[model samples]
Target: MQEKDKLNILRHSRHDWMNVVQVIKGNLQLDRKDRVYDILNEVTRRAEHEAKLSDLNTPDLAYKLITFNWQWQKFHLDIEMIGKPIDCARHEMCWLKFFDQFFEKLTEQSDSMTDPNLLVSFHLQETPYIEFDFQGGIQDMKNMQEWLAEWKVSSSCYVENIVANEQELVFVLNKK
Candidate 1:
């Protein structure tokens, strides 16, 4: 990543922190101590998650995740990531591109829903593969499958799409 990009990310992160602080201050002024405490706990949990992501040493991935959390407003994303950082330099760009397309599709589908939830969990295994579990509502399953098939052909990674139910989909991207 370029120095300018790093600086921009830092600025954005700082601005987000300031906004969180402002919210806490507003709650305090309103004498909503419970709300303030809740906000603090949430912020702390998010900060810990961010720290773990940073430990992965993949700045691009970390930045994209942070930016996604800040930019996406329609759906709440709950990410649970475990395992040590796997060197994924070769697949970073491909993963990022896939995420962009996936999020775009998700946003289009979730626009009508009230408070949609997206749960993403990643576990980096000793077998040198990261298992990504995505559970959410999809508007069009056929379209998404077609897109993923196209992505599979373009990338060297093995893409597995498992349909758990009508509203839930799980994908596992294995390193080829």
Candidate 2:
């Protein structure tokens, strides 16, 4: 996405979240306790979602992961992040593309499932270089690998795929 488009989406997201907060405040002032409480819960959910998409001073990869987490949360899917932190590299944009597709498909599949116990998580490997971890559904693993291969053929960075268990998938990458 273009920088302008991303900024616009984020701006709109902030506005939408604030609207929810205003609803809660207004309902509380009216002494509608039940409505206030209901609105407050919704606001909390939206605020959490916004936080994930909030601008980070780090690289685009970090932003992608954070936004992906938020997207999953908005869909009512549980998301977890592991590891410390890492800086972004030059070839980070490809990673963001992979993450966008990853999260999009995850939400899509999760929404279709009848089971409420399903959860999706993005695990990050703490490294100074370009490396991270991932764990989640089996289908997600396959889709990510495929995207990585396509990215590698046209990109400069190399991404290594690791094993994925029932709970997560693991991978590493180098920023060119």
Report the Cα RMSD per candidate: 3.7, 7.4
Model 1 per-residue lDDT tens digits across residues 75-166 = 77666567766655666766677677777877766534645667665565554444444455667767777776775666466667555455
- Return the TM-score for each candidate structure: 0.69, 0.40
Q: Tally clashing residue pairs in candidate 1.
A: 0
In Å, residue 63's CA in model 2 sits off its true spot by 4.5
Clashing pairs in 1: none
Best by TM-score: 1
**Clashes per prediction?**
0, 4
